[model samples]
Target: MAGTGKAHLRSSDNAVLRVEDLVIEYPGRDGSAVQAVSGISIDIVEGETLAVVGESGCGKSTLAKGIMRLINTSSGSVNLLGTNIAALKGEALRTVRPKMQMIFQDSISSLDPHLKVNALVEQPLKVWNRGNEEERKAKVRDLLTSVGLDPEVVGDRKPTEFSGGQCQRISIARALTLEPKLLICDEPVSSLDVSIQAQILNILQDMKERYGLSLMFISHDLSVVRAISNRVVVMYLGKICEVSPANELSERPLHHYTHALVSAVPIPDPTKVSGRAVLEGEPPSPTNPPSGCRFRTRCPAATDKCAAEEPQLTYAGNGHYVACHHPRA
Candidate 1:
């Protein structure tokens, strides 16, 4: 039902989600505003996983929330399936909310601790009046089994009874109840153990294929992003610094910020010696971010121009884009 109208500017026919110049801010204690997400644009084509990576407070999660319309936005538009969801209100917003779903990082906290797993997953179907009681139960059972959980055994258990990994699987099952076209995963595997992380990731991949879904995966872990994402968007202080294919970004980063991030990824080969780019100090406060380039303060290659003139995201060959005045060769 999405993408019903004519394509707007910068909206791709193939994209399931298109965000343009999106800005989100909060009222600071003082009179000023705290800009959590600066003007940014991105497109996620159908069936592609677009990974958003950055350090803490870099606004990755805020971007995800903005896209989902969980919070109010100051300006810009979020076009989902050709509908500008940012402008939708009340029933209109509720109508489109079912098309996109979000999975949070704290799986246990995200679930309703008092409700049984079957009820939790079936609630969406009930709200939408999708099926009869027996049909809803059958769908819930299929969803639980698809997520690697045995519905017959775990269906009646409350969320508190499950481990973190199992809770996440339940969360995924709940999100898929409506068969959403888009799944926004905000650090969905960060809290689980390494072994458990792989299991959840595998399930997500399986679900994506089974449901024909597009994913917006947000995380701080580069290795995990590399493993699951097709394209990667690197953010710094609420602004995107680079966008590139996942493999290309890992192997050859163009933006200095991206270069530093890639360098921090641990290499598996003991014999391969590589120099790590250690950034100095912490990210500047978003309320009073630095002029020009947001990342210039910690970038080793920062020059006077970087402090005076803002650099826009420009192509750096082979579909890679970087927002840097002096991009690395």
Candidate 2:
């Protein structure tokens, strides 16, 4: 089930990351367990940007953190380049950590305020013992320039001195210090202004090509996801509702939930305005999600079967996969 989604995106045998039945649970009030991610599976092939899209509390961030081993997972395997790092600990985890780096949503807060920009970017290299002092300094200067920052000017200052966009660029440079094969961006541009978002996205695209990196991009912004992603995984209450090529998903979203999400993406042209899928209520509590299909509670097209039997993510032709019982045609 994990590798199946990859076929629907593209017939790629070179998967850089494979997540199988990944589940993440947190302690809830009164000793209960809140499932943040539930049996989510995905694959990101080499040089492909797989965007995980959903509203807040949809487990997008949790999934990303789980893959990076930032937080403990309840169950499942996270395979990176064929090694199941799910249970790896201590030295084993540390050795492979440099190969996968994450960019957080809050750019400024994620960076160390005390450290200068050059030191911050060079920290990964120093920790990993990549090069000598002179070599590391030259590498840092080159990375800063690649991300559109002047090393001599901005490298001396702390993250406080730069704008949100500049700080994010610094973060990108820091993440790329190891020349990581897989980069997981967890809402990296959500905090910036609309104009700043474009600049950051462009930098990310350029960096991906330059570094030959596969990206696991997590965001609630469907429009941005469409712009940057090759394939998209639509999450609802911790489960994937759809997986399709970015352009196909935007123009012909299969799942009802995905349709609602795509419809909400604001159209620039007034002449293209059409009726949107307005979801009726808020999402259900993760602690006690709806039985059968987790999204049945808020799904307008849900029927008795949707409430009685869980729908698995199955191929829906044209390299599109959908889990909804009543998918949109």
Computed on alpha carbons, the lDDT of every model, listed in order, comes to 0.89, 0.88
Model 2 collision count: 0
Alpha-carbon RMSD, each predicted model:
4.1, 2.2
lDDT of 2: 0.88
Which tens-of-lDDT digit does each residue in 1-329 have in candidate 1?
00011122234988899998888998998888998888878889999999999999998899999999999989999999999999999999999999999999999999999999999999999999998999999999999999999999999999999999999999999999999999999999999999999999999999999999999999998899999999998888888888888999988898888888888878889998879887668898888888888888888888888888888777777778878889899
Q: lDDT (0-100) at residue 294 of candidate 1?
A: 83
Per-residue error at 148 for model 2, in Å? 0.6
In model 1, how large is the Cα lDDT of residue 66?
91
lDDT string, candidate 2, 1-329, tens digits: 11123334333379899888888999998998888998888989999999999999989999999999999999998989989999999999999999999999999999999999989999999898889999999999999999999888998899999899999999999999999999999999989999999999999999999999999999998999988999999998888888999999988988888888888878888998579888777888888888888888888788888878888778887778988778888
Report the poorest 10 consecutive residues by lDDT, candidate 1.
1-10
Per-candidate TM equals: 0.96, 0.96
Worst lDDT run of 10 residues, candidate 2, spans: 1-10
